[model samples]
Target: MAGHYVIAGKKIPNHILSMGFIGAYAGAYALYALKPKPAQPATPPIQASSSDEEAFIKEFLAKAEAEESK
Candidate 1:
């Protein structure tokens, strides 16, 4: 009997079946080897000094409190 390609209860050509398998294998290898890197989280900008940070926080809190009172 001559060899036949039977897949999913259907008949196909041997070359088509072999090419399909080769393509699938190549796709899997590409995915495994060429996966994209995860994106890095954004870093906060550097502040000049602790005094400047404290002053900004104090002003922000004062403004927030004024808004709440209104």
Candidate 2:
């Protein structure tokens, strides 16, 4: 049924070729299936003090501005 397209003047259907390819690949690996494994977040050794750092930065900026105004 298949001949050189240049000579046979016929184009093969995409679905037919795709199904044949899928069948070939699936038959080659019929017993096994592939699945993506879930990723786990790394555990941190220490927690950050967000509020404390924010307050310290604000207080430091205020002190710096007060000193500059003098």
Best by lDDT: 1
Superposed Cα deviation of residue 41, candidate 2 (Å): 35
Per-candidate clash tally = 0, 0
- TM-score computed on alpha carbons, candidate 1: 0.42
For each candidate, what TM-score against the reference?
0.42, 0.31
Would you give me the overall lDDT of model 1?
0.81
How many Å off is the CA of 66 in candidate 1?
44
Candidate lDDT scores, in order, read 0.81, 0.69
Residue-level lDDT of model 2, residues 5-62, one tens digit each, is 2326767666677788899999778645555557777643334379787678777777
Residue 62 of model 1: what lDDT?
77
Off by over 4 Å in 2: 1-49
User: Candidate 2: deviation at residue 10, Å?
Assistant: 71
**Which candidate leads the pack in TM-score?**
1
